[model samples]
Target chain A: MSVDTASAATTRAIVTDAAGSSSRARRGGQRHPATSFAGIALRTPYWVLTAGLALIFLYPLIWTAISSVSPLAGTNQVDGWGFGNYATLANYQAGI
Target chain B: MTATLHPPASSPAPPEARGARRPARRRRGRRTHGALAGWLYAAPTALFVLLLFVLPLLLVLQMSGSDWPLLSGNQGPNFPENYQVAVSNRFFMDSVIFTLKYTVLTTVILLALSLGLAMLVQESSRWKGLLRTSILIPSALGLASASLLFYVIYSPIAGPFADLMASWGFTFLGTPDGALWSTIFLIVWRYAGFYMLLMLVGLQGIPDDVYEAARIDGASRWQTFRDVTLPLLRPTLALTTVLCVTGSLLAFEQFYILTKGGPDNSTITIVQLIYSVAFQGPNDLGVAGALSVIVLLALVVINIAQIRAFGKKAED
Candidate 1:
């Protein structure tokens, strides 16, 4: 009986603490309302510029990787999907 | 016995003591934070070098021992076969000799040109800044782009460079002997500015007072330059020469784009030959990896020898 009562009392205290903490958080957020929008409103342009430049610089490397594995490397075939192109390197030492 | 910690109330720790403790505690907090920040700042660079540079190098060294291609998954152990194959190859021998010859020639030319440019620009003239800027512009061009530029410049049918050479009763880059000189000229023009900057830094470090005293003592321009300038510039000269030699030894892009190892393969560098063996002709990356290891070992030995030679000069 004592154990049951103690457990119920502990649960009540936890609920009360959580409710109080959340109320405090909401009040704090309301106090400095501009802080909430500061990140998105101030930093959006920089984020966009960085993303654009990253894409521009990375395009060539992406193209090279795609070209290295492209199926159009062979005589007639336009599309290749498997590792056949990589296998052709085995016939590399046929001559000097 | 269960011990519970508690502060004594009889003679309380002083308020100033508590205040002092706050700063100590703050210092402890800052030390941990600062150490963490240092690690955080260095982590990206460390991880990048570890992953991209170090790992690939180790992988290449491992690949050099085995007869493995780019796609080799699992192969029987024929350890050291690649090394043997590369060692026995006559082309590898020729490429090494060619590379050494080119390195020596290019280093000599680059050092001379850079030193001359440095001397010219070191004068306290009004056009010094303009001259420096003009000289350095060539260095800003990418090696591959510069090679393409030279390819047109060296072409006989379409180049005024060829006409200018012919007017002087000589060809520049049309033949093998001419092509070697032409390539060296291109390299000297490209790198002279960068080395000039290094030389300029060394020249600036010489005290104005020393030059004043030398002038006051009626020292001639030649004597002042020969005695004071050269001795002080020894370290810089040695460093620049090594850089020029190493960079020239690793020559690839300029030759590949300009000469394509032409005129009976007289201009073929070690790296160009390695590229031909690995990718262009045979696609034998195993032999290429072995050759890379050999080249790396050779560079290490050369660097050590160079340091020993110039280090003695510095001591003197």
Candidate 2:
């Protein structure tokens, strides 16, 4: 039993001990946020540009839905009432 | 050694076999970079589909279900009534018949003529490219623009076609049958090259070695084509047929602007009827919405049936 325990200890040491000391030293000298900031700074322009473009292309459908269902029907009139224009479809069935 | 009897080796394990592991690490790093770049390139297209296509389609579907008017508030919760009216309308029936007829006739004639043209041009070494390009030029013209072009082409007084037919002492677009034929011919002229392009692609994909082998085996030209080329071309043939049928079924602009569904509304398509009923004639938005939904469902069913039929036929 003593031999078995000793061998098990040796195996664990081999598996876990290689990078433990080096990793601790590295962590002491540097921080996680610093590395994360470097990564963010390197990749920010791409992410920001993509997010901006997504908003621009998404505006039309948002506007259409809001107008279609909102009671703010301006000169366009499609927006004057909520769901009225959509309801009129029930009465007009020549093509349906 | 027994499983539990083996002792730990004192020697280092060949420096952890560094040779194979290093290249694997390097490859993993390179793969990560490639994946990031691919995502960066594809992000814009993904955003476009998400924001523009998917969202709008959902919004339209919602709108189609409600009693939403342009200038007034939602009066009541009405569902399925719009679809019911659209399905029951006589005008819908007329348009559906017209559209289906146009699709069937155009798709059949277009496939036959285009294949013949491709065969003719394939045999010709000189002017082949030019002929193909010239034939394809008509398709590049916008459909609305093509409609105007054909309008002038079919004009009774000054049109080249009328003059050509005058020599034969006949009118081109005067009678119902005459107008329909002219429309079909115009569509064929405009689209045959496009189908020819697809057929040519299929034809070119066939290996020269296969043809040579068949010839050396004493197979006749017709036999080689029948047994080899046609089988290889089944996929392209099915694709082009589907495209032609769908486009024909959606026929609107030419019939609407040129004929105005004239000759007693013979050329009037379902879409045109939907447009007239919803906007032009009685402003019956209900019926229009209903009709639109039915047509949309019908289109889906037709596409499914077409693919299944093709698959079954191929299996046979």
Candidate 3:
């Protein structure tokens, strides 16, 4: 375990060494951010775009959650909000 | 992938010591136990590959030649007959064409989109963690589970979007195009973050001095990405490309759960056809094994071509 940790740490040190801290040194040296993706200012548009992408990724699972409980017309749905799908899945193949 | 991330093991001297003269060759020789330790560490993975992959591969080869059935023992050898059957199977051509189309589309879209996402998340901004986390969380879901989840979500009668889809006069999986795009969307949503993480690693592995020089030279962001980032990321691209192509070719769980090769069997991938042949109507393991061997061979060829293409690009 110690050998594994030592090797992993050594590799990380090598990575950090190879990558260098020039960007951090530059950032500390001056305040001259511009339009590069890595060097860009953390403006409102950046946050908005990233958040929007996050929503697109997360919305489907959220919708699945909502529809999982909310009643529907043709599924093995109960009369009201319930775990009908979960129940059906639990009973499938002896619920595995 | 692992090789690119680490300093090449063959380089005995550290980068800084390469130009120094301090008996580096003899005095700085490797410890004797290092090789033994490396082998000891690698033993488990080697054992696993030998057991799981090599053993199954040999079995599949044998099964491909013999008249093996799913439920019973194998009969006598049939040699080339199973290969003929596999090639002439009813859905063989259609499934191959569909799988190829899916592979191309998925590879292009996923690679481009993941590159963009990686670029976005690689920024030293506050939202980086949130975006990366959310995007990658879906990858944690098992592919089968994600397929089932999308299956319910794509259900025409019970889905959340059913009403909107009804109003729009279109269903998610009612047609070939719709089914393809919808499944692609699910796949993109699930895998984009994972691939982005990979690309991000590659991006971060690039030395900051190189980008600093680019910026100092007044190189445009686009120019820097094209000349610096793209070239440096070739190995990662090759790895991801081979992986995406292989996974997309062997795609069965998603279609099996979401579409069930349905709405006219337009989405029946090659692996699904293999499964149906072995377990479904035909119940022929020999043919299935032959198909598997063919797919394996194709994968080896495709991966070699991709890696060689990337290698030539690197040399140039």
Q: For candidate 2, lDDT tens digit of each residue in B254-274?
A: 777568787777787888888
What are the DockQ scores of the candidates, in order? Answer: 0.01, 0.01, 0.18
lDDT of 3 by residue, B1-316 (tens): 3555556756687756776745555544655457778999999999999999999999999989999888886997999999999999888999999999999999999999999999877766446777788899899999889888888788777677879888988999999999999999989988998889889899889987688677656689899999999999998999899889989999999999888897798999999999998999778899999999999999899989988999999899
Give the top-scoring candidate (lDDT). 3
Evaluate residue B192 in candidate 1 and report its C-alpha lDDT on the 0 to 100 scale: 76
TM-score, chain A, per candidate?
Answer: 0.45, 0.46, 0.49
Alpha-carbon TM-score of each model against the true structure:
0.66, 0.63, 0.76
Off by over 4 Å in 1: A1-96, B1-32, B71-77, B127-130, B161-171
Q: Mind giving the per-residue lDDT tens digits that candidate 3 earns over A9-40?
A: 98677556434554564334223455655555
Q: Considering chain A alone, report the TM-score of candidate 2 relative to the true chain A.
A: 0.46
Fnat by candidate, in order: 0.00, 0.00, 0.40
Pull out the clashing pairs in model 1. none
Candidates 2 and 3 compared: the better one by lDDT is: 3
| Model 3 TM-score relative to the real fold | 0.76
Q: Lowest summed lDDT over 10 consecutive residues: which window, candidate 3 chain B? A: B23-32
User: Residue-wise lDDT of candidate 1 within B1-316, one digit each (tens)?
Assistant: 9997676865668999889889999999999999999999999999999999999898778768767665663254456898898888777777788889889889988898788778766754444555666667778878887777677666665443557767777656557777788888778767778999999999989876566566556689899899889988988998997898889889999889888887778788889978987888767788888889889899989989998988998897
